[model samples]
Target chain A: MTKMTIPLGPQHPALKEPVNFSLVLEGEQITGSTVNLGYNHRGIEKAAESRTYLQDIYLLERVCGICSHSHTTCYLTCVEEIAKAEVPERAKAIRTIVAELERIHSHLLWLGIAGYEMGFETLFMYSWRDREQVLDCLELVSGNRVHYAMNTIGGVRRDITPEQKTEILRRVSILEERTKYYIKLGTEEATVLARTQNVGLLPHDVAMNLGTIGPTGRASGIKCDVRKHEPYLLYGKLDFKEITHDTNDVFGRLVVRVLELVESYKIIRQVLNYLPDGPIAVKVPAKIGPGEATNRYEAPRGEDIHYVKANGTDKPERVKVRAPTMANYVAVPYMLNSGYLADAPMTIAAIDPCMSCTDRAMVYDTKKNKVRIYGWDDLRKLGIEHYKKRGVDFSKL
Target chain B: MSEFEKEEKLKAQLEDKFGGAISDMIIQRKDRVWFEIKAEQLVELMNFMKTGMGFNRVSTITGVDEGEKLGAFYHLTDENGIVTVRAKTPRTDPHLPTITGVFPGAEPYERELADMFGIKIDGLKPGRRYPLPDDFPTDQYPLRKDWKVGDAYPEEKTSPATEAK
Candidate 1:
């Protein structure tokens, strides 16, 4: 039989971002593939040139809702490097706390997504329910659910109160226990194993050559992580193993993420112990001297790198962000070629795609006075009304 | 095994391989031997570092535009650390041979550099479109200094007919 090509998306239920996966299938097995992207382009780097250094903190934080802290941390680290600024011990500890909290939230969110992809609603519900605790803890510190604008150029914006500290530690211990239980279930559970084991296998050599990062890279036995090697924030000073799995399969990737959740919990507990007392932030000079710096951090997805060039101005001269999903997206065609049609959704979902993180945008509904909600009929009605108002021919837009 | 000795050894080894191609070897702060080389020598230098000096990992491929010139950086890190190889081409006639044949992993990166910087890859198949929109202008490059970001994306406005249609 001739191979038939199936197009998965620039918009599909299986993907969170706008990526088109063109798969050539021989019956149920994928034989070849091509991945396309460029939807939701926001020209974030160019827009960054127009904003001030302080303004860009909140701006960059919105890059990825899940990896929001990662973007801010990466951008702040680049700026700190350029300014030659040393974060205070207390500030560093607090930053570590927030970063760990972000990681916990991100991994849990990914877990829920993975569960949903596998058609395990029970697992999805439980995972999201557990994730709510971390979100609460984050809100206690950062005061936002999605985009926590806590990171600043020199340090952090919010300080954890003594009561908040106790609450955070208590919550961390609770999460640690729940995470341990879930990890046991994930590893030994029959269904998870059936779905994930030996699915989407990426051999070590292929992973290394592909330049994959994070758990995706780790799953394939490629010990490449920016946090472990480059050592950003308190990662160098902190003690935590660079989690890896030798299996190089879907199950292996799941195991790596599960193990990392526990490690993030351990890091958070350690950070709380070393918590110091000091101002949360410092006065950044209005005029920063011209300099360039590159900051790379291991985001929940993979290695997220940001290059910042400052020209002694409040606004940056230029900023380029390299999201990990973009790198991992390259390896998708290879992975799909090795998997069956039954494994397609799970394998595709394994690579967490966040187009908003690669770029940035914000929309306001001025006329509606609330967020705009588009439905098929509503859109059609709006289109009809527009033609009536314009009093022009219907063919041309 | 000492950091200084290792740095010196790598620097010397690199010098021996490509005479006078490496320059401004800084040993501190963002530690990496920064250098510029002819476009043709990049793939050869990358191969030497990967096979000879053990720089097996491609850390990142970044593109920069400097008015009449465009610079591309191939940052590779081994079990040891980072080795940065920077190469450039004239902005008007931006063309570079494909390195994907040697480092299969560099394909996405090369395509990205090509798409964003308007750098043409001589041997790359012409139809491989990754991130650019289907309707994006063929000649306009997003990362070039001259291609004003403001001009690249026109202000998004919903026309009445568009909404109606």
Candidate 2:
């Protein structure tokens, strides 16, 4: 069979963000793949250098709409350490609450995208519908749904009021019930099982060599979570298990995420129950240090790392951000190889990729060559039709 | 053993293995450590850290502009924490050996180093520019201390109507 290459996206509906993937196909199977990024590179790292520590909190929060709190908290962890400020207990608990809620929101959003990619639009609709509960809970506490701006250099910006706590618990319990149903549905649904099982296999060794992190690595049985390995903030005190699955396929990723939703709820309950009473922030000098520090955070997607170097000024000398998506991207080509071309979108989505956070791009110009362009809708429809032929239709649902 | 002690033991082992080459060693905290070494020794140190010390993951690589010199920090990780290996090269002739053979994940980061700070990676496979537009000026390194926003692209042309006005 002759090899044909197709371009996936730089602007396609299949991707939540702008990223391009060039896949080389031999008949129905993908022989090779290359990911191109930089469509969303806003140079936030360079911008952070020009802003003061306090100002950079808001700047870094814009790194990812889904993991806003993760970036801020990670950046501030380095900033606060260099300044040597002690955050209060209540602030830590509040931050932990927001983080867990963000995790629930991000994971649920991924579940919806997974369902949509697999042509199970019903799961997409239901998970997104349930995701609003957590979004509302975040808005209630932090006054905004995304990019909460709840974190500051020393600690958090807001305290959790008792009334708000009660309401949050109420919502969390509701989400818990909904998530349990999802776990049952994800596990037992024949359509989901057929679409996901034995697809996009990432072996355990490949996952580690590529430095894959978060639930993606966990699904491959790497057993490396920043929260468990190097606990920060209230994670050390909170009780939750690091979920792992050794299946090392798209099904394992789906199972890990749905199960992680339950763990997020558990963490939310623990944080609210143990909410302490104290000031939410502390004062630090305008000039931070001639020192540097690196911080690692377990974002909803994976491990988010940040490095900050202060030059005895209000502004930082250097700021570096390593979004989780960037770490997991190296494994995309490896997983895409030897897999059916129809499974590419699901495999990419399984990483919960956030391109804006990674802010990288690539370009491939095959001008004088034969190539096919597949729009987002075309690829999605192709996936649905491909699965329908296998007797796993969700069209009626 | 405690995290702090574990880090200390690792530090001792590293010092024993590559004594004079490593310098400015500091235990930043319990779970983090920092040290500096020559840019030429990066590949050897990274190989030992990966195959010998079990620091199987390269968390991220950071490139910094320090006025007269260009510096890079390879944040290598294992279950314990991050052990940062810092190296510097002259800005006029900045070159660092790539550690992609030891940790394949470092490829993107090394490319990033080449693009942002103009620090050339000795053995990086030639590829398209990353996290930057293809038309981005070759001479302009955005993260360098002297780079300015206006340096990336040419000034926009004035319309004939505007010029007349």
Candidate 3:
């Protein structure tokens, strides 16, 4: 059989953001694959050099809609260290609370996407519906759902009030119950098991060699979580286990995430229970340092690392962000090879990819040398016709 | 052993192995260490760290513009902490040997170093420029100290709507 090459996306129905995968297929099996990025590079790192430490908090929070708190917390950890500011215990607890809540919502969102990819729409709808509880809990604590903006250079920005704490616990119980149901559904569901069991196999050695991190690595039994290894914020004091699975497949990733949701709830409860009474934030000089610092954080997806260098000015000299997805991306081509083309989307989604977070610079001109311009209708027609060749007809719809 | 003492022991091991090659060594904190070494010694030092000292992961590579020189910091991590190895190359002729042989994950980062700071990796496999457009001007390095936004697209002018107003 002759091998064929197909481009998965700079834009595709499966991807939520822009990234392209060129898969060389021999019949239904993918023999080789290459990932092309940079469709969504916004140059946030370049823009960060022009912003002050305080201003960059909000800016960095926009790095990923899902892991906003992770970026800010990681960036501020470096900034605060360079400035040598001591954050209060209460602030640390609050920050950890928000971080874990962010984890809950992010993991639940991934579960929904995973379900959607495997043609399990019922799981997608139910998990996403349950995800709203955590989002609401985040809003109650931080005044916003997505970005949270709860972190400051020295510490967190807001304290969790008593009423808010009680309400959070109430919601936590509900989420815990829902997550328990998901754990059962995820492991026992025949469709999920059939689609994910032997798919996208990333072995233990390959995971560590490729520097894969977070749940993706955890699923492969790498046993490397920044929270457990280094323990920033209140994680050192929190009671939770670093969940891992030995299956090393998409099923392992799903189980790891579902189990991690339980751990997030546990951490959130501990943070709120041990909430200390003190000022939420402390003041530091605007001019931070002539020094450099690096911080690693365990975002919902994996390890998010940030490096900040200050030049004795209010603005930083350099800011480098390594979002978790970027670290996990190297493993994508490795996993995609020898897998069925139909399993590609699920395998990619298993990494919980956030392309905007991964991308940091430059925008490609899709129109530069090409003379043809496909208008909206033309593009729609093209999409329909393209899918028609693959046996999916959308003309009537 | 305590975290700081474990780091100190690792520091001693590194100094013993590659004495004169490493410099500016400092224990930044309990779980972090920093040191500077010549670009020439980077590959060997990284190998020793990975095989001998058990620094199994290259966390991320950071490129910095230091006026006269370009600096690349490889932040290597293990279960204990992070050891940052800073290597400097001349601004006029910036080149660093690739450590991808030791850490395959360093490929994207090395490409990023090339894309942002124009530091060439001596053995990087020729591939499409990363996180940058294919048509991006070859001479323009965005993260360099002297690069301006206009350098990439020099002919750009104010928007027509603003001009009309």
Candidate 4:
């Protein structure tokens, strides 16, 4: 019996984000594992204090590319409550539409990444290719794909036009069909089931104690979806079920996410149909009086919290953000326990860990705007090319 | 019982139970209650909330840097609603009891708070820095009001004391 320790990421092909895990292995079995992450820290919370309530909305929106609306909405909800402002009915509907669309795109992206990690290249391509449709719908609705910037203090920034609503429904219905096929593959595919079934187990009780939320919590049978439990915005009016799977394993999580894709599609349709007619936003005064509020929303990953204390200044007195990854961090070691080292990447991906959301950055090349869709393979090629242009052979190095 | 009444009743019960440690109890809003507790009694209140009062899940542990004092809020969630237990300590030496014993989920939030706000917890396992660079300076807590963003840079002396020196 030999003891060994291996480190995964800050930089690794297996993980998309910057997170380091030191694994202590006895043979193929992982005896102990600890995760270390800080590589993505942008000091956004600290930065928020220096910005006005208006600027903080955009700053907080960039917290996670996948769950941008969740951040802004949580911030807006808190600030709005503090000011005692009522969000217009139309604004709430639009917010819910964007949020559900973000969920759809996020889950599809996670599915592709999960497939890529599993060495199933075809599944990766199929999921991301479908993910583009959701991104397009988002762009059509909010004018930007990643940072929606649609949440204002009193209401939302944008309204859903008739043409936009028609286009969104058409695209989302197509997505629903594609999602059904993925659901079949996710549940019945031998490779996926073999790799995921009963692997990386975090039982229902453990999940509750660790306070895991969203799909991960539901997969473990801990019913803690903030939307279902709290029902903020138009989520109360929307007709959709919170998907739950009691397997408490990687397979269950995969099932839960795929099911959520279908559910999010339904929610988008519901919000679009019930898209109330009213002003999208109202002018909020600069100074919000002394008040405090805790706003929680169900992000694509899990529950996201934004606590705002306004002391009558334009800037929030104190704003604290608790992203889902922070809440789910404690249960990672428990999931990694007794798990195989080979299955490690899939196990980590099952949690759909978002290091950027927890710690945080991204770089956009304006030159490559034509190709809105790209995959890990394309990214790897781009990296090689990016270095090769500097007269360095990346492969040789 | 109505949701609002259940929350008020819960607040009354808590105030009655630990009247000595509590200073003020503010019903912040519907389904939300904020209590100002002594820094020394945060853990005791957290334990009582989780065990006795059935506030089983730890929602969040937020750290706020007030100029002269540091405020920490512990948000606990249950069927009733959310109860936020707050405690403040001096900014010079912010130290309080840790509630990881009651809510294991709060460990990460507490760690981040400890690192970001220069706060000290009496007990939280391992006590290593999280979501921060390993080589990050010990004296400079990023979230503090007085800490500038580029303070670590060579020529970033903004404070008047630095100019005076």
- The order by descending TM-score is 3, 2, 4, 1
True lDDT of residue A194, candidate 2: 92
DockQ list for all candidates: 0.26, 0.43, 0.40, 0.42
Query: Residue A382 in candidate 1 has what lDDT?
Result: 67
State the lDDT of candidate 1 residue by residue for A268-345, as single tens digits.
988888787787777678567588766678888888878777888777777878778877877888889958987887
Name the lDDT of candidate 2. Answer: 0.88
lDDT of 4 by residue, B58-114 (tens): 888888877899988888886436788888999878898778888888887788888
lDDT string, candidate 3, B15-83, tens digits: 998899999999988978999988888999999988898888998999999999999999999875888
lDDT of each: 0.78, 0.88, 0.89, 0.83
Off by over 4 Å in 3: A355-397, B1-3, B155-165
Candidate 1 Cα misplacement greater than 4 A, ranges: A355-397, B1-3, B28-30, B79-81, B149-165
**Candidate 2 error regions (>4 Å):** A355-397, B1-3, B154-165
> Candidate 2 — number of clashing residue pairs?
5
Model 3: per-residue lDDT, tens digit, A312-379? 98999999999999989899999999999999999999999863222122345677944564544677
Quote the positional error of residue A249 for candidate 3 in Å: 0.2
Candidate 1 lDDT over B84-146, as tens digits, reads: 677888987998877776666677677778888988887776555656777787777777667
Candidate 4, A180-278: lDDT as tens digits: 899999999988888888899999888877878778889999877778777899877778887899999988999999998888888888788877777
DockQ score, prediction 4: 0.42
Candidate order, DockQ descending? 2, 4, 3, 1
User: Which residue pairs collide, candidate 2?
Assistant: A37-A360, A37-A361, A37-A362, A38-A360, A38-A361
